[model samples]
Target: MMRASLPLRRGMPTSVLGSVSANLARPSSVLAAPSASKFTSLQSNKAPSNLSKRFYSSKTPNEIASEAQADFDPHAITAMDKQSPPEPGADFNVVIVGAGNINFGSDEGPWNHSFRLEHKLGPRLKVVGLIDPSADRAEKVLDVKRKSFVLSAYKDTIVYPTFADYVRNRDPAKPPHAFWVGSPPAFRGREESGRDLEKALVEAFPNAGIFIEKPVSTGPVDEAFAIAERLKSAGNIVSVGYMLRYLKVVQKMKQILEENNLKVMATNARYIMAYEHTAKLDWWDKSQTCGPIVEQATHFCDLSRYFGGEVDLDSVLAHSLEHFEPAGHLRRVPVPEETIAPEQRIPRITCATWKYTSGAVGSLTHAVALHGYNYSTELDIIADGHSLRLVDPYNAPVLYFRRPGDDHEEVVRYQSDDPFFSEVSNLIDNIELGPGSAPILSSYEDAVKTYALTWQIRNRSEEQVRKLGKGPANF
Candidate 1:
């Protein structure tokens, strides 16, 4: 049946990246600009007296990558360019759950999630169908000329309004092997919740593997945990889109730590995003995008857990500056009047402190109000006699390491490595290799712990804001 596909609205890109590097010892430059300390001192009651009216000069991701390329090995770059051909009659057929621009290509061209997946998997993977309510979105993705690289790669792909609709109408001889949930973070009450969509898909495809986006749930820990439990009970292949875990540099960092048996003592990380560049207002609202911590900052939070071990919920401390300045002075991105409650909006700047189960003290400072496009996503670790840092894991990701007695730090660059390729390829391996063989980087259950920490930070920050009773006047 030739049914009309539903049209869905699209949002701006909020890219997430994690840092990793390897070296016994080498010379180093400062990983990134010295961590901005002023964000932590900003108070809700008082406007930032030193706020810079000008946006910081953006260090374009391409520019950063160019610099990093100068340091990388040509052989590594050449190896990453090679794509392995798929064997005949592979059964890893998949379907996408969203048809927005990010699912196909962004404003800049075919560099979005789906494009990366298609290009990386090549013949090894096949996108047999898509599930979205937006007919416009469906129409857009199918327009081969616009996204020729992505659309042309697929031999044939069907479209449906819902997962159930796709499941019901699918050809029994060629059922979908897995689902890639590309929709935004959704909740129970609101229909756009990705979590709700996943539920329906799981109910329809009992043994299907699912690849989900981050901030798995917009609700509390209980809801997130429930989703994790359901997936576990079904014996489903579940992988959360935490791509940093698959970065070669990150893997090397893990190997270095384990090989040397270095104990992590302390960790510091931050995800300072460009708020002014966020054209959409919903992204700033906690009720919509789940705030930066859950929405975007979770990458670094997960990295903290990846290196520092499990977090101690009892020891978490957090704070935020929801309304950075007087409402009159703020540059507001217009949103539907009264669509989101004032109390539900999250702060532009937030900071949280916690203790890992391993006794390592750690902190994460997330700010979305930066003036530049150069995102600051970094993690620093202090272990036994060494200090290691992963800088700007998103754009031009670099790694730096130094020991107690070293005068120079060792550095490794990954300006050319595509972590997403590594992530998608691993997901494919997991589906084909079954249990114990494939290394599923960030499983749904493990990602839930990261989601829990984000909620804990938000809850803690809210409690502090309540005690201060110094709400911003803009609202």
Candidate 2:
């Protein structure tokens, strides 16, 4: 078994970061600026107070790639780029709309690294502004030489409160090039900044591209569809936060499925994290975060769909365990104060079986009360009189087999320099080259499917409990 460990540390090697900075410092020479670009020249206006020459000029390509590969076994970069070399100095300006942990900084923050990688990749990309409600959090982006402003308490900063506040306030000839929405998922009886961000993007910069975080919402499916329709009508290119879709390992798995001509029989996925990591927040409760199925397990569900093909649930069954006393000394409460009985908390364990329209059967299981923030994601596929298993996400290799007579395991490792960097680089290339140039791995359609699957599991579980006349119901 591959030893699982967190990828981030305070004093871990800064070589990659330093290399990225060096690349940014090098002048842009790769791609020519778009003649019809919407973004105004920063030189024309007094650059945002936070903007600095250092931020723009960071690292060199060789240095960035070298640092990215230092952590892993040495592999030739050419092995992964046989098709096409990455486009350099592509001009793509971005306006990030949320300052969440995933996008800005976190223990294993892909977004944080992605931003730096974008700088190294070329001048085609720039983060111009950050729009978030919390002033403190917004200040983080402002410190990076990007404009930061508190968004109004309205859905879609562009339409509800009027786009003139932010857009018209600026030069109309040059609008934001793109909007990146990294807000948390909207919960039941709670605030939803994503909807607001989407509205703003559609109204203020209908022609700009957009990137929204996952688990789009906790509400009905129709709402998400409506938002998608609006984006489509506005001629915007919207990408969802299904980052795994761009991972090299995931791509290999897809290739394996196609090469084998296999049919999926059953799939099992589990994600376990430390209770201390999740239990402290109000949104940790299943109802608030749209249940474990939607909030946490949706990624695995999306993976299952990717491997197993189109998933249409025939039925779903679920159960929950609440906090209770062993000797009747303490009565379990639905919502605890200060501390919660282990049992009374949200269901630590969840299991569900989904029957796809293609006649494939699949299962999903997950838990969040492990010893530490240790995450294990696996997919077991039984088909063609054989079995294929993918255990542990970060390091586990794919295991495959042929039949009762032929049994073997072959490791499937990323043959690339850095999968995460490759993901961001591809995103930039797609935007620069336009449609058909690069693959669009993650789409709003896939996100919708994942969201609906999660909703089905959560809603079905609550309905089953209601039918059984059980207490401690979920909202």
Model 1 over residues 327-395: C-alpha lDDT tens digits? 313364445424556765667778899987678999999875555445567799888888889986655
Model 2 regions lying over 4 Å from their true place: 1-90, 113-117, 144-164, 187-196, 324-345, 394-405, 415-419, 473-475
- Stretches of candidate 1 exceeding 4 Å from the true structure: 1-80, 108-111, 145-155, 187-195, 324-341, 472-475
Q: Summing lDDT over every window of 10 consecutive residues in candidate 1, give the lowest-scoring window.
A: 20-29
lDDT agreement with native, every candidate: 0.58, 0.46
Clashes of 2: 26
lDDT of each residue in 77-114, candidate 2, tens digit only? 41333434336543455665444444455543333533
